[model samples]
Target: MIIITKNAKKYFNYLLNKKKIGTQIYLFINNPGTQFAECGISYYNNKQFSNDNIRIKYDNLFIYINKNHIIYFKNSKIDVIKNELELQLILKVPNAKKKIIKKNKILKNKIINVLNNIINPQLKQHNGYVFLIDITTNKDIILEFKGNCNGCSMSNITLKEIIEKKIKKLFPEINNVLDFRYYKKK
Candidate 1:
């Protein structure tokens, strides 16, 4: 979501319309957290910079703002203060920062395709199904082993040696695999 202040709207529109060969503008809104408050307007051309909680990709020439940022600026008004020396976004709704998971659709579909075709087919003989629970940037693939494989004694070995190895071999990008099958608690 683009939060354009009344004062900055004109300039922002200009930037969006008259972007040069290699220039991109990104606005970052800080979330309310225990540690600190930090936000800035980032200017990029052709490089990627990532901080602790944010990442900017200049090649795309687009700012993929997070949900938290949007929520933070939802009730805020943007204005140019003090003869254009400073730009400010005033928050009308306090405590509006909400954290939410943002999923990459293309990557997710790619993972699901691989799982359905490769993993599930292989496990069909055991009446097992490989359900992908989640995928992380760290390349950890979380899966739930269902059917006969769920409570099997050798499930751990199957997951670690067989399933994990197969998945890693197929998708070299994955770093680790975790099985999240539900078992009776002792």
Candidate 2:
């Protein structure tokens, strides 16, 4: 559920009455359910208008939010803060930073998730990153290295000792892990 505080309602009224804008505003979220989630407010242009947009009325104005975005807005509160000379809109969405995972996720997605959430952090320390490229019929995992690891002489050792071991350990079905730039399949 979303709550628009009294002060926030007043600010919305001010925006319509004093600013002479339309009676509609759009609530948006970018990269929802991730560590980098962000909430924003935007005005819809004529071309962007659609009757399908779900809206909630707040006396003087209406907030249009996509139905799918409601998940991130659960337990969300919209408020306003009055500073020295400015009124700032505050959006507190507690669930926005939580990662959403489905039970029936594919093997590729599962592997990518582990690489992104686990292995990439350690690689980032050395100014490098690795990502899955392909999974062969033989269950061989192909990975691409970037940044510092791309041309480094130690990449082969790193792949054998660190990346390969980790991938195989996490997903035991995986046969071999090969670096894309270094390993060319015949």
Candidate 3:
């Protein structure tokens, strides 16, 4: 899970509220998959949220990460960097290229175990169960809803508050826990 420093959070909230709808902050590698890679931040409002991006919300701030960028960003933190010339928000991905955990098997299995043991049991009472579809290239978990869970009015609530929170707690290495049905390519 990404951490926004308190100072950065305050500043980001101010900037985010001022932007028009659809605005999102992006953290990316200037030169990916290399020793020369450096992480940077920028803001734009264009494409709507889709399967290709991992949407992260910290309070009112919305950050969008391209699915391919997840491994590079897993352990990163966002902070405000201020100097005499300029002040800005930055993504700090230490050991950027050297530590990409691609398609982590152990973490994926842990997620499945949690779902079966804790989550599905609760959902089973409601005649619902969730299935792990796949771990995306970015390492985000993609889940497919089944039984009562599929097309349930409260599915979003379950995905965000319960399912997502549980997965993030168990595997911080994952970027975003996304429902497969939510993707609408644009």
Judged by lDDT against the true structure, how good is candidate 2? 0.81
lDDT of 1: 0.61
Model 3 Cα lDDT, one tens digit per residue, 58-88 = 8877787787777777668888989899768
Best of the two (2, 3) by lDDT: 2
Lowest lDDT block of 10, candidate 1: 52-61
Question: What tens-digit string does per-residue lDDT give for candidate 2 at 54-73?
Answer: 77777766888887677778
lDDT of 1 at 178: 84
Q: Give lDDT tens digits, candidate 1, residues 1-186.
A: 234455565554456666655555555655543235455555555355444334433333354344446545444444445545654433343324444344554566777898798778878888987788877768788888888878788778888898789888877888878876542221
Clashing pairs in 3: none
> Model 2: number of clashes?
0
| Superior by TM-score: candidate 1 or candidate 2 | 2
What's each prediction's TM-score? 0.46, 0.49, 0.49
RMSD of each candidate relative to the true structure: 12.7, 11.0, 12.9
Pairs of residues clashing in candidate 1: none
Once model 3 is optimally superposed onto the true structure by TM-score, how far is the C-alpha of residue 95 displaced, in angstroms?
3.8
